[model samples]
Target: MSIPALDAQGVRGPAPAAAPRATTPRRSRPAHAPGRVKVWQRWVSPLAALAVWQIASTTGLLPQSLLASPSTIAVTAAGLISDGTLPAAIAVSLQRVAAGFLLGGITGILLALAAGLSRAGENAVDPLMQMLRALPFFGLIPLFILWFGIGETPKVALVALAVSFPLYLNTFAGIRGVDGKLAELARTLKLGRAALVRHIVLPGALPQTLVGLRQSLGVAWLALIVAEQVNADAGLGFMINDAREFLRTDVIVVGLLVYSALGLLTDALVRLMERRALTWRRGFLGE
Candidate 1:
């Protein structure tokens, strides 16, 4: 049997061997890892689809009357842009959407705050909101036109209506879904009501509130499309309607493309906002 080794105030079977120092330096991952897909790679699929569409249109597999060739639509879009028709229409549409979004967003946040902060407010507000939400908002077009007249008021109102529900629902859910432990901690910390809400509750609820904003924006566009169809003399919807009467499929396609592009642009803006606002968030997607 081996005899134990003894040191000052210590005893051991054998002297401990020194841990070997690492020969190779440890490699650390970059703070912002590269995306799985390259930037150019992301565009490949869309470009391929566009090429196929152009080929089909050129080969007469797709009829021009039914769907214009991408080239023809591009030309039509260029002409409209040069004539300032597209810009004017876009401006009008944008104004309506912006106005409506502001109004609806304010209403939603207020309602959500009220219901989220108070049981009595929730009892009074939630049931009516839920009932209103159950109905297809698009179905309210006739009623809106009658009440607000077949003008800008009805169009703006429609967008507002479309925007409000998503925001209200999501904001309410976010407020309620705040971690109970965090709220308890806030209380334990002796946080004032204002301080608790400003620091803890609002920050915690912000992620879902932002999600609601995105959804509301999407629905707002859809509502604007339908609203503009009602007695619209200007805007993309009017442009499409005018093109339809003249059997100008190319022009119609251009208008539709513009609508799609706008939707994508707005969504991208929201995504950028999320990246900036939610820097603390890390999930599978972030990796």
Candidate 2:
């Protein structure tokens, strides 16, 4: 027998097939969904590391002399800061890095442009750059000390040398890698050399040039540390060397932390500059 329906006010009939089911399972959020992480997500691992370090230090698992606790490092750093040593050292190192990087970067760009555009320039300069790039920056330290007499000049020169080759190579590669059809079109259009280079070449090569600049900046920062460590009268590296001599592990720890922080800051700035410079390079594979 068919089921009977009551009036609208007192309906007692089977529900319609189209009736919404309140109990239906809603879609679950993805485990690896983008933007799911907090803005401060990167701090989690570092905070965990600090906690573990604090625990290890409290338990004496790590010798005080060998691995100073975070508190000790902080105290030492504050003392250094209060005495103006840390700031002075940082300033000196940064000045050296800036000078060297600017000099080397300009030379690299000019060399790369010449090589990319001229066969003679490439034949003359590329071999020398490749050889120089292959040589270790540390290996030149002694030579630089000898030639430049272990002064600020030598340190700056060494850092500059360390930074130049990568920029040169990447820039040259970028220029060479530009679309051949575009070049041919420019030629067919009777574009002047200056116009072609300014409008076509520079834009085409900019993305890779930015990559090179980022890479070179990292190298420059590393080289600056090494350079500062070499009989330096004043710098973070010198502080580290001095701390080692005095067996002040806390001081040593402070120097290292400062170095790491400075490196991170510089690298971050370079990355920001890269993002700004290469805004036209969005959505590429492996970006």
The candidate that wins on lDDT is 1
RMSD of 1: 13.1
For model 1, how does the per-residue alpha-carbon lDDT over 30-143 read when each residue is reduced to its tens digit? 211223234567799999999999999999999888888889998889999999999999998999999999899889988998999889999989999999999998899999
Best by TM-score: 2
Off by over 4 Å in 2: 1-46, 283-287
In model 2, where is the ten-residue run with the lowest total lDDT? 1-10
Clashes of each: 0, 0
TM-score of each predicted structure versus truth = 0.81, 0.82
> For model 1, which pairs clash?
none
124, model 2: CA deviation in Å?
0.8
Error of 1 at 107 (Å): 0.8
